[model samples]
Target chain A: MKKHNYSAGPCILPQEVFEKSAQAILDFNNSGLSILEISHRSKDFVAVMDEARALVLELLNLEGKGYEVLFLGGGASLEFLMVPYNLMKVNGKAAYLDTGTWASGAIKEAKHFGETVVVASSKPENYNHIPKGYTIPSDADYFHCTSNNTIFGTQMKSFPETNIPLVCDMSSDIFSRVLDFSKFDLIYAGAQKNMGPAGATLVVVKTEILGKTGRTIPSMLDYQQHVSKESMYNTPPVFPVYASLLTLQWLKKLGGIAAIEKINDAKANLLYSEIDRNPLFKGTVAKEDRSNMNVTFLLNDEAHQEKFDSMWKAAGISGLAGHRSVGGYRASMYNALPLESVQVLVDVMQELEKNS
Target chain B: MKKHNYSAGPCILPQEVFEKSAQAILDFNNSGLSILEISHRSKDFVAVMDEARALVLELLNLEGKGYEVLFLGGGASLEFLMVPYNLMKVNGKAAYLDTGTWASGAIKEAKHFGETVVVASSKPENYNHIPKGYTIPSDADYFHCTSNNTIFGTQMKSFPETNIPLVCDMSSDIFSRVLDFSKFDLIYAGAQKNMGPAGATLVVVKTEILGKTGRTIPSMLDYQQHVSKESMYNTPPVFPVYASLLTLQWLKKLGGIAAIEKINDAKANLLYSEIDRNPLFKGTVAKEDRSNMNVTFLLNDEAHQEKFDSMWKAAGISGLAGHRSVGGYRASMYNALPLESVQVLVDVMQELEKNS
Candidate 1:
């Protein structure tokens, strides 16, 4: 049976890209060398790094604004501490939007480095919706936001225009839509979602935003350290970076960001419409601010959850269970997910509705 | 053309292993999900973590010992700082043998934490030979050594048999030889060389030696944290771990470490014997301390250097240049390099000699 993946992360990848990537790992473009064995400094590996970084800049349509593309170790959890450590000015506070678990996790790490002001939070409502009408502090070092909340299934459709520099943790929805790179000084994401594997963290930071922090930070935690060394500050995670590079190539070949975003939006729409029509499934997130990446929903009767799960598994739909914190279903519709898969999921929901 | 990969670290991997690893990155075990998309808590990833760790322990032949095997982020450079921070106590000294750049790096990072004693150094001879007659300190926290100096190409043939907790940075020559691992309390290696990719670091440490140092270390930096978290402390380098696991399975299927060591010796013998018999070549490291993993040699006629380099590159051989610190030739015969590749290298050396 052909399996359709709905995993929240470590998510789906295009088959064409996957095949080429697999070949490289095996024989590495007829070099008869595994990509895993090459040194980061070698001309071959250097080309991989150079092309990957170049492709990232090309993908975002940002061609030379002094922004660096780095594939670094440690996930977004590390970035939580890093962003503030590098960009937050001396004695200055950074404002953050607390939309979900990851957003709050970022806030927690940022506070340890400098003063973090929560400009907006959905915590009182259990993070199901994005909080609005929150003041953006002009004195703040940067306003941070989680663009797509993976767990809560909410997204910032339009970013807030803050006087201060904008820093967004676009971990879950990067490259899933047409990004406005000029509005934000920096954007970073864990590659597990909408990218490649989990080892590498994709960091895109405007050079002007750096060197503001006066605090003496460790080398690994410093963003400028990575940019200067070209993300080979130490030996990089080569295989993951290669995988991501392949993904960027795949995305580019599929007609850049605009074309993919159309496909992604269509996929998300189908799933969302299904959840709305089916009484057994009630969408968990607010209608206005629902995520186009992760669609979180719950059954009208919780006891039917087991049957629903088993049926989906039997139908070869995997990783549909929502986060336990918001128990039900979450069908992640990233760039790589085919619309047909979403349709399959919708058909299953309809069958359950008819039976009920 | 079958490319002969002589590049040091990240140089080559088995084609089959790379293929398998790349497939997993797309949809692990054909489960129709990117391995990166899956939760670390999932049974699949947990099995990966366990099998990789188990193989390392099994390869080292320490199945029932007090040692704990951990796959952590940050390369051996981080481990250089970590080893002292975890093992060196306030006012407690550790003995170190400085052979080359990596050993010197370890020594410098150690000084930042606690007392350090330099037992012996080969730097006076420009790292062409391993230092000997080092008096191992008894009351010291531990005696540290780099098992094989990657650049200088010198290895410690006989480990110090002292009862004290003997620690070694085996980042270069780990698994290249069969050894009694019980002799050392801690052994670590970066996966770029003999292991798999560049992101993951393998640490085999004795459980009894920890907690003696009273210094407060960060959770991620502490070895105990990885042990307790089962190396998933901070969303580990999933792609790298999977690649490493594939390599491990390949190693086990090839009759484990013992069988590979025999082949390793044969490859080393083939290269060194040519260097010894040929009038055009000369081995740099002392005969007794010659590294079986990385063979460093130089031509007697320095004039052949440029031609030699050109010939190797033209013949599709890569990364044969010696370290900048040592101007010669280094053929790093890591585990992934087939015996045929070594034979090809020897044939090239012979051809170069004949033409000259």
Candidate 2:
């Protein structure tokens, strides 16, 4: 059976990326040493690091724009702590918009460093939509938000325009679509979802925005030190960075973010349309806020749930079960997810409606 | 020519371990999903994590000994800061032995959280020998030491018997020897030298020693919280952990640390004998303090440098160049390095002597 992977993350990646990464692990750049065993400072692995950093800037179209890129270990969960450790001042406040689980995690970490005010939240609605029309406080040292919520299947369509530094966690939606990269002072993403694998976190920060936080930041969490060291402050997570480089290369070869966004939209539209047109199923999030990356839905009747799940399983679908909190289905269509997989889900939904 | 990897780390691993890890990356446990794409919570990976943790305790003979093992990202450098953040209480003091570069790094980070007293240091002699005849302060909250110095090629032959909590960084010599596991409250090793790769840090902490610091630690850096969460406090460096599991399995099959320690001793002896007897080369560190893992030596004459360098390169030897600070050759004989490779290095030295 042809497998259709919808695992949230570490999720789908281009097949070519997998093949290349596998080969590198066996014999990195023909060095006769597995990528698993070579030094990160070795010429071959250094080239992997250099190319990965360059391609990130190239894909974002932020080259030569005073934005520095870093690949660090410890995922976005660590970034939740690091962002405020290096940015939020000792006595100042940072404003956050709580949209989902990840945003709430970020807020919790930030409060440990300084005062944090939640400007707005969609938690009352179970985070079914991105919060909007919230006022940004000028006195806040920075305005932080999560650009996409993987669990709730909602994405922020527009970012808040503010004079305060803007820090966004683009973990689930990075490289899936085009975005105005210049508007934010800092952006970070864990590479598990849209990028490559689970290990390295991609951090992009404007140099000018750093060094203003008066607290003494640990070297590992200090943004300025990492930027100065070119992300070689310490031995990095080498394999994941190499895999990310391959994925970035795939994205660039496929004409970058602009080309992928069109396909992503088509995939989301096809799945959502099937849910709405078929009487058996209903889309979960609001129409305007539906995520192009993760399409979430549910059956109209409880009796059809087991039948629909088995049908998808028999059709070779995996990881479609929704988060425990949401309790339905979530088909994550990352950058490498083909339109055919989305069609397979749509076909399953149609067959279920007719048969039931 | 068969290649001999002598890079400090990410260094080398057993051939079977590499093959198994490579296959896992391509198709993990016949799941049709690349290890790179599988969720950390998946049964396959959870098994890998569980087995890896179990093997660590088993090898150390610490099973059911109240010690908790964790695999985390950010390498040993991050642990430098994390150790102090979680263990050093406000206004308390920690005693550290400054053996070499990494120990100094740990001392630097520890001072930021609490008072750090360097009870003894070998810096006066360019860190070529481990300092002795110094006393660890009984009033200190803890006594910290680095077991092996990769750059300086020094190893502590004995540990301080102190009532204070003992913490040791065993990055270079972990799993290569047998030690009294009960003597230390915490033992942390970066997985690069004698283990697997460069991302994950192996932490074994006695559960009772935690939660005494009375400082607010960021969740990512808090040892007690990580223990409660079972090291999935966040998405771990999944690939590295998987590879480490395979390596640990390889170690166990080869009879664990006691068995590897014998091979490691043989390899170090073979290499050191050549360096001492050849007359063309000389060992660097003091005899008693010489590391069984890393053997540092220097050419007697600068004039034979090119001839000896090309001779080893032609023999398929790699990473024999010493650290810049030491300005000599370092043959790191980790457990994965076979005796035949050490014989090859010795043969090359003999050939160079004959040619010179």
- The per-model DockQ list reads 0.52, 0.73
Clashes of each: 10, 0
TM-score each candidate: 0.91, 0.99
The CAPRI class of candidate 2 is: medium
Screening candidate 1 with a backbone cut-off below 3 angstroms (N, C-alpha, C), the clashing residue pairs are: A9-B37, A10-B36, A10-B37, A11-B37, A37-B10, A37-B11, A37-B12, A38-B10, A38-B11, A39-B10
**lDDT of candidate 2 over A1-356, digit per residue (tens):** 33688998889889888888888777887888888888888888888898899899989989989999999998899999998888888898899999999999999989898899999999998999998899999999999999989999999999989999999999999998899998988999999998888989999998898999888877888989899999999999988898899899999899999999999989988888888889998888998999998888888898998889999998888889899989899999999989999888888888998899
i-RMSD per candidate, Å: 2.5, 1.3
Q: Model 2, residue B312: displacement in angstroms?
A: 0.3
Pairs that collide, model 2:
none
Per-model lDDT: 0.84, 0.89
- Candidate 2, after superposition: displacement of residue A344 in Å? 1.0
Residues B79-104 of candidate 2 have per-residue lDDT tens digits of 89888887777789899999999999
Estimate how well candidate 2 is docked, as a DockQ score.
0.73
